[model samples]
Target: MPVSVLLVEDDEVIRRSVALALERYGYGVTTAEDGLTGLELFREGRYDLLLLDVMLPGLDGIGLCRRIRETSTDPVLMMSARGDALDVVSGLEAGADDYVVKPVDTSVLVARIRSLLRRTTFRPDPAPDPPPDTAPDGPAPLVFGDLSIDTGGLEVFRAGRPVALAPTELRLLLEFAAHPGIVLERQTLLRNVWDYGWDGDSRVVDLCVQRLRKKIGAERIETVRGFGYKLRR
Candidate 1:
């Protein structure tokens, strides 16, 4: 099935143009002019991805993204005419998997959408040997402090309780857990976790780390001054 997208933009011109472009690329595009209607549509139908404009009527993109996060971990891509650091950071902090400045090329928009979707299906590499002895079938969980990461099952547990994480956050944690005690550069994280190669934004990595820390315990992942971030083993 073609990937489905929910695009919420208040600008008629941009909404129509983007919807048309996405359709041309064989996507199942659904367009809404405002945030409330978008939310309604979202609640009514399932989508592979979401493309939300930051500024919207009724409810803004940030608010909408937060609402969605309450119930779903599906990939969300935020678009905004405001490209300032504050605006971009706000979107990411609101649980957006990715952000794109408005007036964006349709090709680039499609690429970003594909990247987010790709992450939804991502699985971590085979886990390390199951904590000495206690043998089990399949890949074993990687334990860090009180946190347990079942890479094969793609589940995270904190102190024996499950932790709900968005795909981006889970992937980031997996990368850090895979390389415990080693500082992972922002660029390296962007490539491995976000699949952003060179066209990457470090703030995305930074904000995601912040969110992941909140769930898995802030002290578990340490900031390495100018180097990068490392998982506390």
Candidate 2:
């Protein structure tokens, strides 16, 4: 089936143009003119991804994103006319997986959408059963002081309880877990985790780290002054 998308924008021109572009790219697009209507559509239909404009009447993108996060972990991408630092930070905090600055470039927007969708489709093959009295086959969950990451299952546990993590957050944690105690540069993370090329913003990495810390414990991830971030050993 064609990848389904829910596009929510208050601007008539932007909404129509974006919907058309995605359709041409072979996506099944559903457009909403306001945040409230967008929320209603989301609750009623199943979509592979969500595209939201920051400034919307009734609910606004940040609020709408938060409401969606309360029950769903679907990939969300936001667009901001200002594209200021504050707007980006707010959207990420509200559980948006990625954002695009306004005057939207169709190519870049599609690339971001594709990247987010790739993560959603990724699934590590389940390991064959382990030999008796030995560890399970394939990739086992990485264990930290109080956290556990099951890369194959794509689930995280804290103190033996499942942690509710968005797809992006889980991917970030997996990256950190893969290289425990090693400081990961922002640019490297952007490339490896977000699929950004050379030119990418570091704020996305920083905000995602902050959100990961909140779920896994702030002390679990260390900020390395001018360097980068590292997972505690």
Clashing pairs in 2: none
What's the TM for model 2?
0.94
lDDT, candidates in the order shown: 0.91, 0.91
TM-score of each: 0.94, 0.94
Please provide, for model 1 over 122-177, each residue's C-alpha lDDT reduced to its tens digit, 9 standing for 90 to 100: 75466567767776677768998899998888899999999999999998998898
Put down candidate 2 lDDT per residue, 205-226, tens digits, no spaces. Answer: 9998998999999999999988
Runs off by more than 4 Å, candidate 2:
125-138
Give the CA lDDT, 0 to 100, for residue 141 in model 2: 76
